[model samples]
Target: MDTLGALALATEPPTDNLMKRNPVGRREPLVTNIMWRNLFVQALYQVAILLIFDFDGVRILRLQNESRSNAEKVTNTFIFNTFVFCQWSICSSII
Candidate 1:
């Protein structure tokens, strides 16, 4: 019983030592400043990309059409086969 009690006490953390080691007051402002600076820089980069890149509505529509056509061609074979099989099964069942 004493050994078990000692083991339990050993497993528990020394909060007093940990509290002394931590410098929460000094680090919070530094971390918050870094986070704000990072966000500001990211916002500036996004604005620059929008201003300099060809990201207009017409270019977006053209890219969407090209992607759709390419995807249709890639999936055409499987789609056609499934449709034909479904139609054949329905006709055979009805007849």
Candidate 2:
């Protein structure tokens, strides 16, 4: 047989045992739990930071001031709030 054929023949098909041997799958349950706990904690931290930085009285006042009329101001505020919510959702998914 050619070298390529010989090499191909030497490789065995994957099995459950092979999957079990993977380094990623060998982590302890405690390690996996800790990783998940950290991820949730970080996500909460990011949410808190975003809330602190993005939603302020000054920003609301600026939005209110930019509109020409009461109806326009309400519409503008609704759009701005929707945009902020969408941004937060995207950021949370990314993080």
Candidate 3:
């Protein structure tokens, strides 16, 4: 057999732990194949939204509020707030 086939035969499936008892005898699920697949699907959805949908809040705001005098200030504040929110989200998810 090829090396990849050998490796696959040697290792249990990602969800094997969820299906069977671990060394600790707990049946709780850790990170599993389903979780990884869900994460991958979410990432693809986000990428599709970003690329095909062209959902830009700043552009929409500028187009909708052209007469507003504080457009630059509003856009700058929006960008800063978005950056902070993304940073917070990533950090929280990691923890």
lDDT values for all models: 0.54, 0.59, 0.58
Alpha-carbon shift of residue 12 in model 2 (angstroms): 28
Worst 10 residues of 3 by lDDT: 49-58
RMSD of each: 22.0, 13.3, 11.9
Q: Per-residue CA lDDT of candidate 2, range 33-73, in tens?
A: 77788778867866675554355533554554554576455
**Which lDDT tens digits does candidate 3 get at residues 1-95?**
14555565568565766668546546757768988897787667655544432346547665455644476566656666655665465445544
Error of 1 at 61 (Å): 14
Per TM-score, the best of the predicted structures is 3
**On lDDT, who's better, 1 or 2?**
2
Best to worst by lDDT, what's the order? 2, 3, 1
Q: What overall lDDT, based on C-alpha atoms, would model 3 receive against the true structure?
A: 0.58
What tens digits encode model 1's per-residue C-alpha lDDT throughout 61-89? 34455575664453454445545665455
Against the true structure, candidate 1 reaches a TM-score of: 0.28
TM-score, every prediction: 0.28, 0.30, 0.35
As a whole number from 0 to 100, the lDDT of residue 86 in candidate 2 is 56
Candidate 2 TM-score, C-alpha based: 0.30
